[model samples]
Target: MDFDPRLTPARSDLAARRLQARVTAERFVDGTPARVVVGLAPLRRGPRGDARLDTEALAGESLTVYDEDEEGWGWVQLDRDGYVGYLPTHAYMKGDVARPTHRVTALRTFVYPALSIKEPPLDWLTLGARIAGIAERVVDGRAYVITASGGVVVADHLAPLDRVEADPVVVAERFLGTPYLWGGRSSLGIDCSGLVQTALEACGVAAPRDTDLQEAALGTPVDLDPAQWRRGDLLFWPGHVGLVRDATTFLHANAHVMAVSIEPIAAGLARIAAAGAPLRSVRRVERPQ
Candidate 1:
């Protein structure tokens, strides 16, 4: 099968072998499927700790492992976004687990041993992470969702697997002030495209991981006229993107401020232009009226 070397984790293997094949195909070398075990595992460009972080894998996310180096790093592709990178082999567990029945909607939530909030947390879940076996239990008049893993999470922080938010911008706004982090997808930190992707995905809208790919594939193109811009519209630059908070404001997880922030569109436009990356295009994602 044909694939872009830059995006494929197994590019080196492809060069060594004349034919290309899917990871699931038997002809593919050292191919195995695994699931991420940590809450968030950094996917790096290289096997070393000093390697540049390229992306991240949320807990229970599937990974297609292509190879493992002597240093214990596995070259893999993240199934959620198809991002390729290296991570420690121990971070993954072989095979998939049961599909999640609910998704964590809060910035972060704790998994407790019982319904009581006083108990020490057994684990922590980030926004967009999925969990299975939801059983509602009331504790001191507050409802909690019990997980199959024998943990309790705040009910308000979870949404049924079938439910999705109506407005992506509203979801994005919930992350205002989140720390900026390159290749991060969780609320602990996030990047420009990560914010957009997470917000859109929470609303049942699919999006890619990087600005360039997102600029090419997401939403219908619109003229750069400010009057035409609406809430939920996406603004793009060479390596950056932001969501329209309204007709006059732009919201983004920006490195300039090192946090998610909202600024006047005119000022944001000038700021990006001054940096030599002029606004490239505007793309509008329709929301229910």
Candidate 2:
């Protein structure tokens, strides 16, 4: 049996307690539950500073900590997308996972210590970041939400977690021009798969973290011919993914352009073919709009 290392919590020295029957490890223990308390924390491929980033854990996101080293790195699995990686131990609160009451629907917003926007910002939150709101306030005709921890966020930027967008493609369109980032899922920066995953999340879809995982987990496969494509279809290449904006175009956060851009599918096919990564598949996800 093959287990993907990216999602598997088993290392040579130890493994999760639940995986004891499936994996062989020197030790097995139930992992500790935690929640990201910081605005965003980098999840690295390794425990070192120079290690490649695998993804970013958003504020209030749930995680299970499998191992914590003296070096302050925690090996954990993100509960949202099942991504396993190393993150700074102090970036998360070691306790029960947070129960999110609101989700950031805007591309990004600032957090304040007071109800006034004039107050020095405490931090910033990106799209899809979740918060546990305990109260709401209105000042100067603007609404704000008071977090369970006393942080204030503009209510206009948030929505109840149950309030989802109507269209994933329309949600994707909102990220146009976002800077390209290899492992980022935030509006400040995003990668090919992160863009797709973030957009789908807004529509209440649970998408995996990376391209290959997303490809295998999302919608049914369909013909790759451009004419057969629809607005909500997903196009996958070897290490890339994009959403169909319409029949003639698709949108993606590409390293080629170094930003999110809509490109003509005909031009994209030729350019990608020239680069040796042709379109591999098109998947149609049937959902509201």
The model with the greatest lDDT is 2
Cα lDDT, all candidates: 0.83, 0.91
Stretches of candidate 1 off by over 4 Å are 1-3, 14-27, 287-289
Off by over 4 Å in 2: none
TM-score of each: 0.89, 0.97
- Write the residue-wise lDDT of candidate 2 on 158-204 in tens digits: 99998999788888888899999999988888999999998998898
Residues 1-289, candidate 1, lDDT per residue (tens digit)?
6666436655533321223435323344546778776667889988898999888888667777877889989888787888888888888877655557888898888888887889998778788887775579887899998776677889999989789889888888888899999998988899999999999988887788999989998989999888998888999999999999887898999999999999999999998999999999999876433
Error of 1 at 220 (Å): 0.7
Report clashes for each candidate as comma-separated counts.
Answer: 0, 0
Any idea what lDDT model 1 has? 0.83
**Best candidate according to TM-score:** 2
